[model samples]
Target chain A: MEQTTIRFTLNDRPITHAAMPYRTLLEVLRDDLGLTGSKEGCGTGDCGACTLLLDGKPVTSCLVLAAEADGRKVTTVEGLAKDGKLTPVQVAFIRYGGLQCGICTSGFIVAAHALLESNKTPSEADVRAAIGGNLCRCTGYDKIVRAILAAAYDEGELVDESASMPVMEKPLFTEGPM
Target chain B: MRSFKYYAATSWEDAVAMLSKNAAAQVIAGGSDLLGWIKDDLNGPGAPRADLLIDIRTIPNTSYVKFDAAGGLKLGALTPLVTVAESADVLKNYPGLAKSALSPASPAIRNVGSIAGNLMQRPRCWYLRGKDFACYKKGGDFCFAVTGENQYHAILEGELCYIVHPSDTAPALIALNASAKVVGPGGAKDVALDKFFIGPRTNVLKETVLEHNELLAEISVPAPAANWKSAFIKVTQRDVYDFAVVSVAVAGQIEGGVWKDGRVVLGGVAPTPYRATAAEDALKGQKIDEKSARNAGDLTLVKARPMSQNAYKVDIAKNLIARAVLSLASA
Candidate 1:
């Protein structure tokens, strides 16, 4: 396959790079662009380690071709934070310790970010359904669910009268690189 | 994955021209299934990898869902599974399809998997997917699942192979009586959803009847009639993001607990979406109660020949079919 010049908006910035047609987005992001935040647990779509937002929807980056980026907007885990301020989801993960091995954290954060953006106040079922694609074998999904609920609460997105409310708390060692 | 030449097709006609020009060319809509298939190197029956890929997603006006009350629903081949799952019109008319669309892999997969891609998905046989096996589905000497790990193999139509079709939406679409539009080098033609799939007895190399030079263009589903209710039930190994063990999709016209002519399509039990005509025939003009529904399920699997390990699937299918019918009847 002939290598073509691929152009797309990545993390709110326009990018252009020469890439082969058979190369995947995850490969180009990690190798060429130095955006190594996204990990590749499985090259296939079964594992959600290489998830990113394509046009505001969570899609497995490993399955998407580089050319399909497609002249469209792409959002990786690095794009979630602004300046030095962390998003509620990220902070909640730190405080709640939602990850164990931390390989699936970035993908979960990216997917959960899309969920919150679409639905500000999501229920527990909603949270589970949105991040269902992301697999975290280490945490058993309890703390991860708690972290997402706590994040939604801190973001003022959780406003349900029937479900139990999660209280936000401060945890030690808040300053860290994900 | 093998390296392949790529061309961004501008239109349907251009895509056809590109496909017709290259013998090893294949059109890609979503790339979700195709990329994974390429990565796995599972070319069904030892077909060569597509050396040239024609990206039809670059073709405009191909990703849309048009709904008309009288004329029914028309979905472009490029329409994403998430779009179909969340469409207001589809949910209103055919909630079973929405459920089936959402029932695959997960939200991420559903968000990008196209309608035609879903229908054209290959079998999920472990022997076929793995490169080391090279089973019968991959044109090897023998089918490994016959005497080795036949847990997930087909229970009904295991002729020379024991592979089960992996498309959840196909059963729902077949129950809804959908038709697919195919555009090839010759011209365009419509194929009924049930007739579109080819079993292992007919040809194990290809799942759909589409030729190498053809591509699915659109899917059209007839509108539901008055007092029509439909539902889908899928028995999976896991709670979410798993393939069906035994899935049932039921659509019929029922009034006051009396069910008329209905359609029952089963997935994860055969090489194609197997229609339970015996169940449909037995349920005609009958009251859809627990007993009647159970009887219908029995009739559906009356001639099923279960494999050694997959005989459990027969029970699961029977229970699922009755549950599906009862759910719709109660609705």
Candidate 2:
């Protein structure tokens, strides 16, 4: 075995860390690089909770080997905001109440942000396809989809004004049965 | 999760030489499948421990999709599944192959998963991947899937183990009559997709015929003839991101409202891509219609022996076969 030093552009910052060759990018990001924004829900590729943008494409960082990230551009959820201002995706997620537990929020936000970057206006199906791999047990996905669509609407130069979904206003039961 | 030596291979020759030199070394491009295996500690009879990993994605000129008149189609092993699914030439020439590529886990996965890696993905059988279950796929004596939760297990060729093939592209590639290029220390060689997969009967622990050091370099699909029509359809538990419950890939040569030649392949049914040769022969001289397609589909699953909990797969597979064939007939 040989000692490998991994150097890559992470979140617009050059990070040079000494990590094991078999370590995943998620482990290195959370443990070594001290970037814990990316959470590991499933160590496998099934869950997108560990999603990151590699060269502007969203991929499950849990499956990407750390050594493979050398000389590549990697973007995590921490890099979304700029100048201490929340991005549209973050604003929409808050306005639309896209998440409840917030464990899967970062991955969803990262995936949606990547989608909006590629396509200014994404259809409902497009949004679904983009975040299809992400698994969120709390949110039923309706709000998330709505928030992404709303973000797209905002990007089309429309004012973000609407009585969007309330945090918890939907009544499952209108009246008690006699 | 253990530390292992790594090398970024610059060329196929370097990769082969490295692999041949180190018996504990393994080759990986996307690292999606191999990392999962290593993290789960899923080492069994044929699932050897990878003490070293050779990164093949560093090899230049490996991600490409080229199609020409004489060569038909050429896909580099490292070409991302997303690229293959969205390629215009692939969509125009081989729609089934593209559909198969798109039908996998999700866009994020397809964005990083490689063409050859998809074929090399291990089965999702709980017993095989689970460290607790001592199944035949993990070099155990008995198969827990046969008596345990086997709703997603094999129904066709449940010889020693009942693990169904997890690859979505293998069936479509076999239906399209594709070939794979294997590079190794012995040099490169071509293998038909049909012969590439070894079933549980021959080797229950392993999936493909690739030796320890061999790598699937590329996949080449022949161009379709004038009247050739191909289609791939999958049925999954989840709508967008799940493996197939049952899938059918149909390709045929149609002339004069009759199918003179055809190939029918099924996924998530057998250990390997189950080639329904009987159904293929049955549709050879038949005028493909609703009734004839139904008959062919019935013939396709006639030999199926579904496990206790998976009898529903038979009906689903039959219906998909009919639908895929009928769609091809209309195409």
Candidate 3:
């Protein structure tokens, strides 16, 4: 198969690269871009180590083709720190003991960030729903959920119980670079 | 995975044209199933590595779901399982369909998997999907599931092949009397959901009745009856990403406190989605009480011939049928 050039915003900077058509998004990010925070626990979509933000929504990068990420903004764990300051989710992860081996931390943070960006104040159930895709074998999920909750509370937008909620609109899924 | 020539279709017409022109071409939409098959090197019996791939994701108008004014649902073939599970109209009128799509697989798989791809996915039999076994599902002359670890094998129709339909949404759709619109080089045509599968004796190479060049265009679901209630129950070893041991989809209308028009379907027990006609007959014209439901469940499993390790599936199917029927009765 002929390789195709893919253009996307990685972390905060725009990147353009040529890759094989069948390579996974996980492989491209870790190999071509040298961003290895996204681990490959399972080549299939079962393990969420390869989770990343494509256009600000969390998805399993392993299942997605690299060619599918064309013209999209891709975020990885390397992008979480700004000006040497840890992002709020990252800080909460440290303070709340959300890491053990730290392998799953990147994917969990990405998943939590995507969840909180749309839902300012999500309930425990909502947090669980959001991060259900990300699995952590070392640390039980209690601390992870707690860390996300702490971040949400510091952000100071509590869930309003009386208001009716609407389903958030999702981003359009497009084919990635092949 | 073997390297293949990749062509991204800007439109459905282009995809159909490419498929018609190349016999070795495979349609890839989500790759939730295809990639696994390729990486595992288990491409079904007589099926080789796809030499050419037609990426169906770029096809216009193939990723949306809409409802028409005539009380029918039109689902484009590439609509994601997550979207189908979360659709308002789908949840309202066809909750069973939503439940089936949402039941198994991780949230990420649901997000990436397309309904059409799931329907076209190869069998989940360990020998078929596994990389180690070279059985009849992988072009071998003998089926290993007959003597190998037959736990997940079929119980009802274990012919030369012991595959269970891998689509989490197919049984529920069949229960709702859905039809598929397939477009090929010969043009578009529709096929009923029940008649879609080809068994071991029929065609071992293909799962569905679709022609080589045919691409599923849309899935059309007929209107439900006025007093209908439906439910889908799947039983598997794990709550996530596992194929069903036995599943049940029940849709029925209750009129005058008696079950009227109804359809009962079973999954994971046959090559294709199996209808429980005897069970449906037992409930028709009768009030769906606990006794009748149990009887119906029993009737559904009367002829089950489980393989060496899957005999437990019969009881599981019976229990699931009763549970599904009772839920419908209560609703």
TM-score of 1: 0.95
Docking class of 1: medium
C-alpha TM-scores of all predictions: 0.95, 0.94, 0.91
Q: Please give the range of 10 consecutive residues that has the lowest summed lDDT in model 2 chain A.
A: A169-178
Clashing pairs in 3: A66-A177, A67-A176, A67-A177, A67-A178, A68-A175, A68-A176, A68-A177, A69-A176, B105-B241
Candidate 2: DockQ? 0.71
After superposition, which runs of candidate 1 have C-alpha atoms over 4 Å from their true positions? A156-178, B43-46
Give the better candidate number (1 or 2) by DockQ. 2
The TM-score each candidate achieves on chain A is 0.86, 0.86, 0.84
Question: 1 or 3: which has the higher TM-score?
Answer: 1
Per-residue alpha-carbon lDDT of candidate 2 for residues B111-207, written as tens digits (9 for 90 to 100): 8899999998888888888887767776779988777899999989888899889899889999999999999988899999999999989988788
Q: What is the interface RMSD of each candidate, in Å?
A: 1.1, 1.2, 2.2
lDDT tens per residue, model 3, B214-318? 888899988876898889999888645578888899888988768897899998988888889999899989987889999999998888898888899989999
lDDT of 1 at B308: 82
Q: Which lDDT tens digits does candidate 2 get at residues A1-178?
A: 5557988999899988888787788999999888898889988988899988999999999998888788899999999887656677877787767899998999999999999999997998999999999999998898898778878876432223334533433322234320
lDDT of 1 at A70: 71
Model 2: lDDT of residue A54: 92
**Clash-forming residue pairs, model 2:** none
